[model samples]
Target: MKLFLIGYRGTGKTMIAKILATAWNCEWADSDGEIERRSGKSIAQIFSQDGEASFRKLEIEVVRDLATGPHKVVSLGGGAVMGTENRTTIAAQGLTCWLQATPATIAQRLEQDSATKSQRPDLTPLGGLEEIQTVLDQRFSVYQSCADFEFDTEGKSPNQVADEILVTVAKEQKMNS
Candidate 1:
């Protein structure tokens, strides 16, 4: 099964995916990066030029394509789960781990990540902490509903988070067996 990392941006989905894939000896893919590769544009460019609806369309296709393969870790775009089809595909094909944090933590992380400013577009006019809070409020329940496992990344290193997820996955496998 694929292991999908789902959560808001700056929650370390991409970084954790890399760690998990290395630990599990599997390949990994980032849906946003894949979308960029396919479109020949960054996510910010996609949102600015083609609009969110268009980007969501590409996200759906990328998620579907990523799901059809051997076991792998997949880091999904933050809003990828907003689409019913994307949620359904992820639920049916993979186990989802939601990495969560406070809006303040997210804001700090996003601020530190140079790529975030360049590659990601703002979802609301009220950028920074306010926007993080607003978007998290809207997405909180949806993220909760879809998560098979949830990890608070507020105080942990990426390796710690990955180790915890690996432990959870191992326990789950044991229980199933």
Candidate 2:
């Protein structure tokens, strides 16, 4: 089964997906990493050189390729599902789960993770909590509208999120089985 993990910039989607994939014996696909690999540049460099529109086109291609492929857990970029076509493609073929975090929480996490921020094209623009809040306020409705399940993860760790996903996956498996 394919599951699409979506959330804001600093949410633990990647870490959780990696752990959950290991725990569940599933293949893991990180959309941003894939996009960077396919594009041959860091996302920050991509945004600097090619801009958001170009990066998003690459994001769309990565998402489409991933969402249509074999069953795997895919951690999507923050803006991946902004496009209706991307949302429709994911929703049509897989379950989309939203990992929710407050803008404060995201800023806190981002500030602590300089290495991650160095590679993240989207996070570099934000100065701090206020900037993050503004962006979150702008995009949150879209994130909510696209998700099939929403899980609040403000104070949670990677293991906690993975546990929650594992439980949900088990329940879904049982129901479907």
Candidates in order have lDDT scores of 0.95, 0.85
Shift of residue 67 alpha carbon in model 1, Å: 0.8
lDDT string, candidate 1, 1-177, tens digits: 799999999999999999999999999999999999999999999999999999999999999999989999999999999899999999999899999999999999999999988899999999999999999999999999999999999899999999999999999889989
Error of 1 at 103 (Å): 0.5
lDDT of 1: 0.95
109-165 in candidate 2: lDDT tens per residue? Answer: 988997666787554455688778877777889998888788888778889888888
- For model 2, where is the 10-residue window of minimal lDDT? 117-126
Clashes of 2: 0
Query: Best by lDDT, which number?
Result: 1
What are the runs in model 2 whose C-alpha is more than 4 Å off? 122-126
Per-residue lDDT for 88 in model 2?
88
Give candidate 1's root-mean-square deviation (CA, Å): 0.6
lDDT score at residue 25, model 1, on the 0-100 scale: 94
Question: What TM-score does candidate 2 get on C-alpha atoms?
Answer: 0.92
Q: After superposition, how far is residue 26 of candidate 1 from its true place, in Å?
A: 0.3
